[model samples]
Target chain A: MPKIVNHEERREQLAEAVWRIIRREGLEGVSVRSVAEEAGMSLGSLRHYFDSQSALLAFSMQLVAERIKKRIQSLPQDGDPRENIEALIGQIVPLDEDRLAESQIWIAFSTFALTEPELRPLSREIHDSLRDVFRNIFETLAQSQLLKPGLDTELEAKRFHALVDGLLVHGVIASEVVLAEEIAGIVARHLDSLLVP
Target chain B: MPKIVNHEERREQLAEAVWRIIRREGLEGVSVRSVAEEAGMSLGSLRHYFDSQSALLAFSMQLVAERIKKRIQSLPQDGDPRENIEALIGQIVPLDEDRLAESQIWIAFSTFALTEPELRPLSREIHDSLRDVFRNIFETLAQSQLLKPGLDTELEAKRFHALVDGLLVHGVIASEVVLAEEIAGIVARHLDSLLVP
Candidate 1:
């Protein structure tokens, strides 16, 4: 039998290699050559999958987004709304090793996207999707009568989004100061403040 | 007579060149040679001011921190506590062109610092200083009897710090979505929530 390769699996493996390099050396260190070397593949073979460095980076970032989306989708939604929401956010923030790595890759990609116009669309899409997540959380709270009456859900959604993102940034950059426990506590406190007293 | 050159002024000029390059081309475009060309100076002359690229980047980052600190210090201290706090935060977020530039440079440098060990201290110093800024805001509110009763100022400080930073990141990365007015409004609303109602 001839050798067979699963293209999607191979691409994911290459993306994981990109993530490892990003975590260890920052996005600036990411290039097609370096990624191919890290993935233990020849440069020509890597090119067959991703024609350019920009395409490779976009795929890596997209994979991060997809993983978070899949995790959130698989989460149990039948439990307490607050706990469910926390669980959803837990997958986004850097609470554990896997999440910590994801957050690092995210920040690295986000900062790089600021200057790379070709990468900006993926960054914007992720931003919009995250905003929807926050919006849906507020909607769920309002539908369940968990939100305080007369609160502007739109503005509150924006605030909640900003707060979570800020926590992610702080958690990644100054994990020593803003510990994981503190991040969870802050989220819980914010959630409590939203509910009827 | 020989022309006189102000050493400090010249260095600031070079730093400004670095800032322009960062804003235009991102940090990846920054190099001693590139910066020298951007500043209309010989590479040898630029090296006289900054012996290495690392030294140049450090000084540029330090200049940003100092500018922010100077701006904060110059703000009038005698004012309504809420407004004072708002004004203090105004200097930190991307509310204006100068601040937007500062924030871009900051995000770029902060992401770069993640894998650059030599730059970590400066990043940490800025993080600590920003934390102190938030801590003092809450303390000031408490002393003035403006804070809501029974609120945990320590945790609130961290939350407030994270929120403003989150706002800053959104403002820089998604200015069209977040908007300047939205950033200001979010800060005002957060302050209102902190006060006696």
Candidate 2:
């Protein structure tokens, strides 16, 4: 039989090649030629998957978003709300080698998206999705009767989002100085302040 | 009369040119030729000021740091402690057009600094200085006895730093949706959470 081609798997392999190049040489290092070389594939084959640089970049960025979604989905929701929150926050942060790489890719793509208008929609979609995620977490608190009285869920959700964002950005940029436990501590304190006795 | 040139002013003009390009076209839009055209100067004249592309980029990035330093220095300190803290936070956020431009350049440069080993020190320097600024603000609160009892000033300062960073990142990436007033409100709420009764 002729060689079977799994197009989805091949595309993912190519996207991973882009991620590897981005990690090794920054966003500037990604192009059809370089990615193909990284993937040990011919340039034409890579082009068959990604017609242009922006298309490849957009796909790679979207891939990052998809992975974030997958991680969030995989968190155990059938648990103590606090544990679920911890697991969700843990998934977002760069706590280990895998997460650190994802965070790096995220920073790279997010920055690139700022300048590329075509990618702006994807950026906004991710932004809104994140906001919704935080909102849902807050809503979960409300449903469990865990939220403090007089708390504005909308504002609290946004604040929580900002706190997580801050920790993630610091943990990646200043990883040498910031520790995982400290990040957890900050998140925990923010939660305690928002919680009722 | 001989034609006169204020070297510092000329450099500022070129850096501003770089900033415009960064805000309008992203970091990749920047090059010696493009910058010279944007600066309305001959390439030879531009080279007279900056020896190479990397040198120009470094100086441009440093100019951003200098503006940040200048803004912080110029903040009125002889005010109510809360007002002083607010002013300090205001300086770090992208509230106005000029600040927004600076922030755009900052995000672009900071992202570029990653994967670039030689530029990491500058990025670290900015990161450290930002930490000190936040720490100093919390110290101001402590001096005025504004902090809530039994609070950890160090952790609060880091949390505050992260909050501002997240706002900056979000404000720029999703500027269409995030507002200046909202950013201010979040900052105020964070402070209120930490203030004495």
Interface RMSD of each: 0.6, 1.0
Which stretch of 10 consecutive residues in model 2 chain A shows the poorest summed lDDT? Answer: A188-197
Docking class of 2: medium
Clashes of 2: 0
Candidate 2 iRMS, in Å?
1.0
What's the number of clashes in each of the models?
0, 0
TM-scores, all models, native as reference: 0.98, 0.96
**What does DockQ give for each predicted structure?**
0.85, 0.77
Error of 1 at B197 (Å): 3.3
TM value for model 1: 0.98
Q: Distance from true position, residue B180, model 2, in Å? A: 0.6
Q: Tell me the tens digit of each residue's lDDT in model 1 across A1-197.
A: 98799999999999999999998899888899999999999999999999988899999999999999999999999999989999999999899889888888888888889889999988989999999999999998999999988888989999999999999999988977778999999999888778986
Residue-wise C-alpha lDDT for candidate 2, range A122-142, written one tens digit per residue:
878888998999999999899
**Candidate 2 lDDT over residue span B1-197, tens digit each:** 99899999999999889888888888889899999999899999999999877777888889988988998898887887887888878887888877777778777777888877777788788889999988988887888798998888998999888889889888888888788899899988888888986
**In model 2, which runs have C-alpha deviations exceeding 4 angstroms?**
none
